[model samples]
Target chain A: MATVEYRNITKRFESFEVMRDLSLSIADGEFAVLLGASGCGKTTLLRMTAGLETVTAGDLLIDGLRVNEVPPRDRDIAMVFQNYALYPTMTVAENIAFSLEIRRVPKAERRRRAEEAAALVGLGEHLARYPRELSGGQRQRVAMARAMVREAKVFLFDEPLSNLDAKLRAQMRFEIRQLHDRLGTTTIYVTHDQIEAMTMADKIVLMRGGTIEQVGTPDELYDRPVSRFAADFIGSPAMNFVEGTVEANGNAPAFVAEGIHLALPVSLTVAPGSPVVCGIRPPDLVLNADGSIEGRLVLAEKTGPDVQLHLSVAGQDFIATASRDAAVEAGGLVRLSVAPDKLHLFDPQSGRRL
Target chain B: MTVHSASRRRLRIVAAWSVVALFVFPLYYWITTAFKNARDIFDQPPSVWAFDPTLKNFEEVFGISLGFLRQQEVLPGGGNFYMAPRLWDSIVVAFGSTVLSVTLATLAAYALSRFPFRGRHAFVAWVLSTRMMPPVAVAIPLFFIYKDVGLLDTYAGVILIHAVMNLPLAVLLMKSFFDDVPKEIDESAIIDGASRWLIFRRVVLPMAKGGIAATAVLCFIFSWTEFVFVLTLTQTGLKTVPVVSSSFVTSTGTAWGNMAALGVAAMVPAFVFILLVQKQLVRGLTLGSLKQ
Candidate 1:
């Protein structure tokens, strides 16, 4: 229900800084996700927004009002922690109503709001049960319900679904997305899982080593990552990077590595002798009988829907994902081709996309 | 059915029983001795069980004189002369000391646990070192100071000494207990619009009930049976149960019967104190460290 802005925010623990000169704005009602690996300051940024942590030097605005000195209780924000943090002693109903009780809402209204939120999280029957009695997924629902009942201006989720098993994580991911759509609250979620960021965020903020790397929509980041780090981090099986030199071949451009050459897209503008790293996503590399690039399959793994093949060209390793029906044997020679536009080129030294 | 397997099972059972007897025998001896008459205590082969049980020992203990006999009574240079029994006096001193010490120590422990302040670690180390010092070493200086302040033979003097003696242990134990509670629970309350004090009252304190109970029990045990300080500082009137029991041994005769009864009375509180906390003691001690 409110926009959040971080202007030149920095956090330090003693002499070591965790977040430095970080500035980003989340529009009102936007599902923005701060994505990064552990200790990359994503959760630190989220906690600062929730007023659970102090910003070393900056302005944190909620609804355009600075909240640097505001305590968490007065910040009018709700946070769902990774561990749920549901009061072990309280029943589901009490947990959900805790905020309302703190705000001194009437008992009847508290009960009504708690029931409504419980129904939203699909925990209507679990109102009387304590957190310990609930399953992991149910405990998570109770945590969600607790946040929902507050109806605060901002919703901060610090890797809320990371604690669940794979199946539960996927299911809760959908539920969270649906809940966001329904509530339309200005939410800032922090997670290290790029897949979660891709599936859930309207805008993703990629961070590395206490600074923002790139911020964009999921498709924008996947289609054109600004750096090698982004390209490598935002995909499953990760993007394959091959170090090579760009060479002009009869008006066409090609990347030349040791004992190997890959023809670049016709639109590539890199001059000859330019040191570059070419990135190819696993799924984009197709396995065809008449494909241009040939390599021996080093390993093949059948993972239900797709079979992943680890192919070696000369001395370099490459991964190719094919349909489950494809019959590929380890150590067998196979040709792999990728769409021209799907290839990403980066400057070797700086790692910036070229 | 196998010989090796049977012997192995027997060995395991014997080991378990040995552990049980190791802890249980001392308590059993104390309980049996509390009931024995004077003759049975010194029988050729000391009786394990009381042949003639009597409450006479208890009666004799309650009736015993506990006043200090002044060495220079009616001195040439005049001074007040007095001989008094201080059983009731010790009870007052111990109770007063335990309450005052534990209350202050608990508050100190809470602050050390919850807040981050300047020199917090150094302060904790300093308090812990105070406990490491032998009670006898501190008793010498404390005795002179209390005497100078006109606190000789006063209940307050003994109580104050006991409180200082027990405070460090109480503080250290409580700090560990408070640390065991997860900080996430506190943050959850904080984000819910509850103030810091409210969080402590409704969330932290309730969760720490078991811990506080455990600390109180430990503090009470230390304060109740402290003997050295009470013996040195208090010459008359203000005597603890341990100090009263010590008086029973003299050159004239050792009143084993009276001593045993008084010893049993002192042990009763310590026993009951542990029993009260025994429910939470196991959980509080482990604090779920064994759980994955």
Candidate 2:
């Protein structure tokens, strides 16, 4: 319901600078996910948004109001921490109703609002239970309920589902998206899991070394990553990269490395003799009889619908996702081809996309 | 091999029980001495078990039976044996100082746990160091201060010194307890719109009730048994049990029966206090110093 904007924010811990003059804006009602690996300053950004951490320089604005000095309570934001910081001594209803109780809400109204929030998170039957009596997923929902009960202008989640198991994490991701859809609260969720960002974010902000690498839609990040790091970080089974130098082969450019030769798109404008790293997603490489790249099969791991094919081409390890029904065998010869558009070429020196 | 291990286990049990009995033997002898006559107390080689029990010690020490008091051949100033006032003094000083010290320590500890003042660690070390000096080393200096302020021999004077003496250990215990309650909980409460004071009183304090009880019981015991301060500072105005128990060693030969009676009676309140907090005590002793 409120816009959150960080303008030229810089965070330094003593002498070590963690974030450097980073600026980003989150639109009202947009689910903005800050995605990065550990030690990447993602959680620090979320904590600053919640007012738990002070900004070392520059301004933080919520709904266009400068709030760098505002206390957490006055900021009017609710946060769901990575550890689901529920009050261990309080019942589920009490934890959900705590913010209202702090504001001196009447008992009857607090109960009504608490029950309503609990029901929305499917925790109505757990109203009287303490946090210790709940499972990890249930505790997570209680935390979510606690945040939503306040109806705050901005919702901040710091890796909220990282503790849950895989199945539960997926389900909670769906439920969180549903809740965002229903409440339309401006949410800034920090997570290192690319899948969470891909499935849940309206805007994905990929970060590295405390700076924004790219800010785009999930499809844009996965399909059109701006750098080699983005291309490698966002996809499952990971994108495979082969080091080579591009050479002119008539109109097209051929990438040549030790015992490896592959073609680049005709439109690739990188100087034909320049060194570059060519990348391709696992799903983009398809099995074709007349494929240009050939390698000996290593391992075919079937994951229900698709098989993750691990192959050794020349001296490098490569992975491709093959259809489960495709005729494939371990240690057999495999040939795979990629569409020219699916190939991503990055500058070898700067790692920038070519 | 199994038989050898079983016999070894039996020997371990016997050794453990022997140590326990060694500790409990003195207490058993003292309790039985409270019920013995003057003659039985001085019996040849001392009576371990067989003794004709009598209530004369309790009756005389507590002034329980007026008819019995009338039967005794007494000196004109016979108030020396009446120790009910000294028992009352011990209870008042112990309870008073425990309440005072625990209140101050809890407030100081919460601030220590949450605030980031410069040299905060050094400040805590300084607080604890106050208790490191020998009690006798401070007793005489304290006596002069109490006398100069006209507080000597008063309940307020003794209560103040005892509370000051116990504050160091009390603060250390309470501060550690506060540290054990995760700071994340406080941050969460703050985000929930509760002020620091509200979060402390409503959230942190209730969670640390077990630790506070443990600290209060320790303070109560220290105040109850403190000797040199009461002995050095007070005279006719007041006397607690530990110092007053020495009065039974007058030149007219020790009144072993009456002294044993007073010792047994004075231990009840402290024993009852320990029993009341026993559950919390166990948990508090292992409090978050170790990972769960």
What are the runs in model 2 whose C-alpha is more than 4 Å off?
B1-22, B66-85, B250-255, B282-292
What TM-score does candidate 1 get on C-alpha atoms? 0.91
**Model 1, B70: alpha-carbon shift in Å?**
35
Query: Tens digit of lDDT per residue, candidate 2, span B1-292?
Result: 6999999999999999999999999999999999898899999999989999877676667766535554543423574255544688999999999999999999999999999899999999999999999989988998889899999999999999999999999999999998988787788899999999999898788778888999999999999999999999898889998887887788878878888988899889999988887877665432221123
**What does candidate 1's lDDT look like per residue over B1-292, in tens digits?**
8999999999999999999999998777666666677788778787876477766556556643324542322312243211223455656765677788767876788789988999999999999899889989988898899889988778888778778888898888878876776777778888998887787777666666677777777667777778898888877556778877777776767767667777777776667667866876665432221111
Q: How much is A137 displaced in model 2, in angstroms?
A: 1.9
lDDT of 2 by residue, A218-310 (tens): 999988999999998998989999888899989978777776667777887888889889888999988988888888889999999989999
Q: Chain A TM-score, candidate 1? A: 0.97
Best by TM-score: 2
In order, the Cα lDDT scores of the candidates are 0.83, 0.89
What is the per-residue lDDT of model 1 for residues A212-316, given as tens digits with 9 covering 90 to 100?
999999999999999999999999988888888999988888887775567788888888889899999999999877677788899988899998889898778
TM-score of each: 0.91, 0.92
Model 2: interface root-mean-square deviation in Å: 4.5
Q: Which candidate has the top score in DockQ? A: 2
